[model samples]
Target: MEIIEKAPAKINLGLDALYKRQDGYHELEMIMASVDLADRLTFELLPKNEIVIETDSSFLPVDRRNHVYQAAELLKDTFQLTQGVKIYIEKRIPVAAGLAGGSSDCAAALRGLNRLWNLGLSLAELAELGSKIGSDVPYCIHGGTAFVTGRGEKIDFLPSMPQCWVVLVKPKMSVSTSSIFGSLSFNSIQHPDIRGLKQAIEADDYLLMTEKIGNALESVTIKRHPVVQQIKDRMMKYGADAALMSGSGPTVFALCEKKTRAQRIYNGLKGFCDEVYIVRTLK
Candidate 1:
C-alpha cells in the first residue's frame, strides 16, 4: 500500500523569545499558521526492514540525519514493528529556509506510516513521538494556525486566521537557526505582543493582525544579512499590509490583503530573490 500526504509550510506571524532556558533551548511564544506552499511525501510498503528516501534536493541528507528517516525510525521502534517502508520526498518547499520543510516532511511520514502499517496511534501520540525528533515536528503533525510555546513543542490550537495572500521570497543564502538564537540577547529584547496577535486572529481582524505582526529575532537576522531587511522594505514599498521575516529566516513573507497586490510583489521580488511564491493562508 502507498499513502501520500501534503505537508504544508509554516510562517510565524508573531514570535517572541522570553529567555534562554537552562536546558539550552530558548523559551518562546509564537503564533504560527500554515501556508499553501508544501512538500509532498509518499510512502510505499516494503517487505524488508529498511527506510529509503528519494528527493530532488541535493542539500538534504538521506541518511539517519534526515528528519523524515528519523520519524520512521522513531515510529518503528515505538510500535515494535518488524516491517519497513520506502519514503519518497517531493521537495517543493525550500531547504534550510526556516520554512519547516524537513519538519513537515517528518510529520507527514509519521502520519502516512501510521496508516500504511495499521499502527493505531492517535494524533496526540504521534505529536508526542514527534517532539523527540525536533521542536517544530509536533506542530507540523497538526498543521494549522496555532499558539506555540516552550521551544515550540507545546501547541494550543487557535481559530483559523483571516484569509490573505502570502508572498514568500527566499534569498540565495541559507540561515542557521542555532546561530540566530545564539546571537540573541534575551535581556534587551523587545518582545512582540503575542496575546494581541492571538486576539486579532480570533476576531479575524486583518488590520489588527497586521499591527501586531512582529518577530523578536528579526533584528539579529537582519544584522547578519542586510538582504533580509531589503526584502522587508521592498514588501512594504510594494504595498504589503504587513511584512516580516519568518522564523530564523532569510525567507521573508508579506501578507497582502489583495491577491493582485500579492502577485505584483511576487513579480517585483523575483529579480532579487532566487525563489518566490505567492500562496494563500492555509485554511
Candidate 2:
C-alpha cells in the first residue's frame, strides 16, 4: 500500500523574540500561515527493517540527516516496529528557505507512517512527537493559521487569514538560522507588536494585517545577506501592499490583494530570484 501526504510551506506574518531562557532556547511569539506551495511525500511499506528515503532534489541527503528519514526511524524505534518504509519526496519548496519546508516534510512523514504502520496516533500525539524533531514541526502538523509561542511548541489556533495572494521569492543562496540567531543582539533591536497582530487577525483587518507583518530576525539575516532587504524594497516598488522577510531571511514574501499586482511582483522578482512562487494563503 502507498500513502501520499502534502507538506505545505509556511510564511510568518509576524515573528518576535521575547527573551532568552535558561534552557538556552529563545522565546518566540509568531503568527504563521500555510501557503499553496508544498512538498509531496509518497510512502511505501517495505519488507526489510530499514528506512529508505528518495527525493527529487540532489542537494538533499538521503541518509539519517534527512528529516523524512529521521521521522520514519523515530516512529519505528518508539513503537518497536520491525516494519520498514521507503519515502519518496517530490521537492517543490526550496531548501533552507525559512519556510518550514523540512519541518513540514517531517510532519508529513509522521502522519503518513502512523497510518502506514497502523499506529492510530491522534494529531495532538503526532504534534507532540513532532516537537522533538524540530520547533516548526508541530505547526506543520495542523497546517493553517496559528499563533505559536514557547519556542514553537505552544500553539493557539486562529481563524483563517483574510484572503490574499503571496509572492514568495527565494534567492539563489540559503541563510543559516543558527548563525542568524546565534549572533543576535536582541537588546539592540526593536520587536514587532505581537498583540497588535493578534488584534488584526481577530478583527479580520486586511489592511492592518499587512501593515503589521514584521519579523525581528529579519534584520539579523538582512545584515548577513543584503539581498534580503533589496528584495523587500523591490517588492514594494513592484506594487505589493506590504512585504516582509519571512522567518529569518533570503525568502521574502509580498502580500497583495489583487492578482494582477501580485503577478507583477512575482514577475519582477523572477528577474532577481531563481525561485519565485505566487501562492494563495490557505484560508
Candidate 3:
C-alpha cells in the first residue's frame, strides 16, 4: 500500500523571543500559519528492512542527514518494524528559505509512515515524536494556525486567521538559522507583539492582524542581509496589507486580503527575485 502526504510551508504571522533559557535556547512566542504552497511526499512499502529517500532536489540527502530519513529511522527504531519503506519527495518549497520546508517534510514522513505501517498514532503522538526532529515539526504536524510557545513545542490551536493571499519572496542566498540566532543581542531586541497578533486572529480582525504582524528576528536578519528588508519594502510598495519575514532570515511573506493586490505584489516581485510565490493560508 502507498500513502501520500502534503507538507505545507509555514509562515510566521508573528514571532517574538522572550529570553534565553537555561538550556541555551530562546523562549519564544509565535503565531504560525500554514500556506497553500507545499511539498508532496509519496511512501511505498519496501520488501527489505531499510529506509530509502528519493527526491528531485539535487541538494537534498537521501541518507540519515535528511529529515525524512531521520523521521523514518526514528519510527523504525521505536516501533521495531521489520518492514522497510521508500519515500519519494516531490520538492516544491525552496530549500533553507525560512519556510519550515524540511520540518514539514519530516512531519509528513511521520504521518505517512504511521498510515503505511498501521501504527495508529494520533496527531498528538506524532507531534510528540516530532519534537525530536525539529522545533517546527510539532506545529507542522498540526498544521493551520496556532499560538506557539516554549521554544516552539507548545502549541495552542487557534481559529484560522482572516483569509488572505500570501506573497512570498525568497532571496537567492540562504541564511544560516544558527548564525542568525548567534548574532542576536538581547539588549537590542525589538519584540513583536505576539499576543496581540494571536488575539487579532482570534477576533478575525484582518486589519488589526496586519497591524500586529511583526518578527523579533527581522532586524537581526536585516542587519546581515539587507535584501530581506528590500523585499519587504517592495512588497508593501506593491500594495500588501502587511509584510513580515516568516521565520529567521531570508523569505519574507506579504499578506493581502484581495487577490488583485496579491497579484500586483507577485508581479512586482517576479522581476526582483528569482523565487516568488503567491498562495493562501491553508484553512
Candidate 4:
C-alpha cells in the first residue's frame, strides 16, 4: 500500500540565539508553527532491497546527500528490514528559504516509511530517529506549534497560535544557514524574548505575540540580502500586523489578522517577487 504524507513549511514567530554552544551549534529557543504551504510525499514499495528518491524539483539532490534518503537508510539499518521503497516528492515549498522544507520532507519520509514497513513506531519514536537527521526534524515530525530549544532537539508543544493569514515572499536568492549563523556576533546581536513570545502564544494574545516577534539572525541576513528587509518594509507599508524574516531567511513572512489586508500585501509583493504565497497557519 502506498502511504502519503504532507510536509508543511515551518514559520518561526520568534527565534533567539543565546550563544555559541560547545557542539558548534548556537544555543537557540524558537517559537515555530507550520503553514498550509507544503510538499507531498508518496511512498510505494520497491521489490529491490534499496531506497529510491524522486522529486519533481530539478534543484534537489535525490541521492544519499538528500535528507529523505538518509532517513530511509537510518530506518532500514535500525530495523534490519530488507523491504525497499520508492519515494516521490511533490515539491511545493521553496528550497533554502528558511522554511524547513527538507527537514519536513525528511520527517514525512520517516513517518511514511514507518507505515509502509509496519514499524509501528510512535511519533515520539519517529522523532527520536528524526533528530539524528537535522535540528528541525523533531519539530517537523510533530507538526503544529511548538516551543523548541537546545539546538532544536527539545520540543515543548504549545497551544495553537492565534489564527492569522501569512503572506510569504521568497526572494530570488537562496541563503546558506551555516554562513548566516557563522556571521553572528552573540555579543552584539539582540536576543528575541523567547519567554515572552511563549507567554503570548499560551495566552492567545496576537497583539502581544506580534509585538514580541523578533529574530536574532535577521540583521545578519539583512546585511547579506537587503531584499529581506525590503520585503518586510513593503509588507508593513501594505498593512501587516507583523513582519519578520523566518529562520535564516531570504523568505520573509508577514502576519495579518484580516484576509483583506493579507490579500493587499500579496498583491503588492506578487509583482515584485517571483515567489509569493498567501496561506494560513495550519491549526
Cα-based TM-score, every candidate: 0.98, 0.99, 0.99, 0.99
List the global CA lDDT of all models.
0.92, 0.92, 0.93, 0.95
What are the RMSDs of all candidates, in order?
0.8, 0.8, 0.8, 0.7
Per-residue lDDT tens digits of candidate 2, residues 55-87? 999889999999988899889889999988999
lDDT score, residue 250, model 3?
95
Off by over 4 Å in 4: none
Q: Any runs in candidate 2 off by more than 4 Å, and if so which?
A: none
Q: On residues 46-118, what C-alpha lDDT tens digit does candidate 4 reach at each position?
A: 9999998999999899999999999999999998999989999999999999999999999999999999998
- Quote the positional error of residue 271 for candidate 3 in Å: 1.0
lDDT of 3 by residue, 126-202 (tens): 99999998989999999999999997899999999899899999999998887888788999999887778888999
Q: What is the lDDT of candidate 4?
A: 0.95
lDDT score, candidate 1, position 148: 95
Highest lDDT model number: 4
Location of the lowest summed lDDT over 10 successive residues in candidate 4: 185-194
